[model samples]
Target: MVKNHSSLLQNKEFQYFIIATTILDLGKKLSWVALSWFVYQITGSALSVGIVISASTISPLIASIIAGGILDSYNRKNIIVIENIIRGLILSLIPILFWIDALDLWSIVVVVSINGMLSSFTNIGSRTILPSLVNKNQLESANAIVSMTSQFGYLIGPSIGGFSVALFGEPMTLFFNVLCFFIAAFLYSLIPTESYQSQNHQKTNVLSTDNRMRKFFFDTKEGMTFLLKFKPVLFIAFITFFFNLTYSPFETMLPIYVKDILLTGPESLGFMWTAFAIGAFLGSLLWVKIKRTFIYSYALGLIIILWGITPTFFVYFSNIYMIYTLMFIGGIVYAPYNIISPTIQQILIPNDKRGRVLGVIGLIGGLGFPIGVYFSGMLAEFLGASTIILGSGVLTILLGICVIIHPSLRFSQMTNLDNIKENL
Candidate 1:
């Protein structure tokens, strides 16, 4: 196992891919913070901020369906590089528009929507390309490494973003974001094209435009059908959706909880998130060292149970330090599910169908976040954020228990691709 991991690290193309993804994640996080602050600064209305944020969030969900077909039909490496380049070019307009005093709220929303839509392709491409980069035995380690470095962006991006805005202003901060994306694109381009040659040689093509559209829909339907027929993947996807639904409230309501419940300031909220990011980063590292192969379904259930339990403590604890500690521990438990779930999918899904299947899974799982946030916000207005959060935690715990006891998931374990295909 250690030898495989060491050899995986030695693969220079994989190294470039990881660095590119980390930089891409950092740019996105930084831009999100900068854009949110800028929107609020200009409008002084939380509603405007919500509109802009929702534009970015909702656009990606809409694009994932098309993104899946594009991923399968195109070279994923080229798609990733092109997407990043387009994103950088689009984001450059923000700073330029602001400089010329031509930037409007609507224009910002439009740019963010376009970038968000493009990002779906890059995000899915990153995952689908992973199986080509590393051997199956090294997937867990590769995933953990990817997750760990990517979490580094989450850990520092917002802090740097806020500081950059204060010191350099929104336009400059946005320019910084553009720079990050361009550099990430360059890094991705550094990876030799030959690395993905085997994966891309099987692309499907149609000469007729009408037939291409028809083929696209047909491929999309086929992907969904495969996901439904594969019971274990289907079950995991459902669990992921439920998990997002129950956990999103914790993220969406954290600021209010810090302010009203803990009677703290923005600094305290920052500290809490930082603590969680630190824990998540360490957890990813620890996961890389762990030797045992998990029964993916059972392990996910247990992880979710622990994850749900950690946040429930928020209902009881009023101490800010205690909350930070719990957030840190919660982060640790959350890391494993992210690593295990995708690794299992990559192992089981054939390379030909992998992109579309992952895309459908992405759409199914992604729906929970925006829907949960929307409803949770509405419910919080009536029941209070604390009550809503408590309910989310409890519901999550119940869902985890359901997974553990469910006839399909309970008996499912990690298996080789051949066995999974045979069973299917």
Candidate 2:
């Protein structure tokens, strides 16, 4: 197993994929920190910050409708490369417009919306392409590596973004984000073209436009149908929906919490995120070694329960160091879910239908994010950020308990897909 893991790491294509993922995620985290802070600074409203953050999600939900069919039919590598480059180009306008003093909240929303729509394609493409990059035995390890390294971006980006915004300004920070995307695109482009050729690549001859449209819809339906029948994946997606709904507020409310509750600035916010990222990074490393011992569903339930309990303590402790400690602990419990859940999907879903099924699942799972973001902002406005966060945490604990006791999920042991399927 160790030799195989080493070999998986040695594979040049996988290396490029991991590097590109890290850099791309770094850019995204940086942009998010900068944008969130920038919006808050300009408007001084938690509602406005939520609106801008939620704008990024709205288009992605709309795009997921057909994103599956597109992924299944086209080269995922090309999709990722093209989307990254386009996103980079689109984001460049932010810095430019800001410098010229023409950037407005509405324009920022529009740009973020466009970028979010493009990102859904690349995000799904990256996940659906992962199984092809390593051997079956290496899948779990690859996921661990991906999760760990990706957290490296989270570890560094927010800190850099906060300081950069403080020192240079939001415009300059955004320009650096633009550069990261372009560089990541270049890394992705370096992966051999033939490596990720779509197995379900559809070649249309002289079919009429109407016929093609029908075919596309038919393909989409087929994928959705399969996902409905796959009880384990469906159950997981159901859990994810609530998980995202409850957890998303943390993103929208964090800056507000920093400014209003903690009475601090961007640097403290950056440090808070960095603390969480550090813990998550460490957890990912540890999870890779110990993941074989636990049942999948039970482990996830316990992790979520711990994750929920950690943040609730924040309501009692307002000290900067205490908050950072809670976030670090929260990140540790949070890391495994990110690694294990996706690996489960990869193991269960067929390669040909992976894109469409995952796309629909993503759409389903993501349904709650924008709602959570929008409402959390509103709730925070009335209830206060700390109060809202406490409520969210308590609600999440209940959800985790539900997961632990649920018959369909609790019996699912960390074993082969066939065993897991039977247990479900």
Would you list the C-alpha lDDT of every candidate in the order shown? Answer: 0.78, 0.85
Q: Please, what are the lDDT tens digits per residue for candidate 1 over residues 303-361?
A: 88988998889999999889989988988988877787788788877777777888888
**Per-model TM-score versus the true fold:** 0.89, 0.96
Instruction: List model 2 lDDT by residue over 221-313, tens digit each.
Output: 999998887787898898888988888887789998898889999999889989999999989888877636556678878888898898688
Q: Considering summed lDDT, which 10 consecutive residues are worst modelled in model 1?
A: 197-206
Candidate 2 steric clashes? 0
User: Which candidate's lDDT is highest?
Assistant: 2
Q: lDDT for model 1, on a 0 to 1 scale?
A: 0.78
Model 2 pairs in collision = none
lDDT of 2: 0.85
- Model 1 lDDT, residue 306, Cα: 88
Residue 257 in model 2: lDDT: 89
* Cα lDDT, model 2, residue 124: 82
Relative to the unseen true structure, what is the C-alpha lDDT of residue 328 in candidate 1, on a scale of 0 to 100? Answer: 89
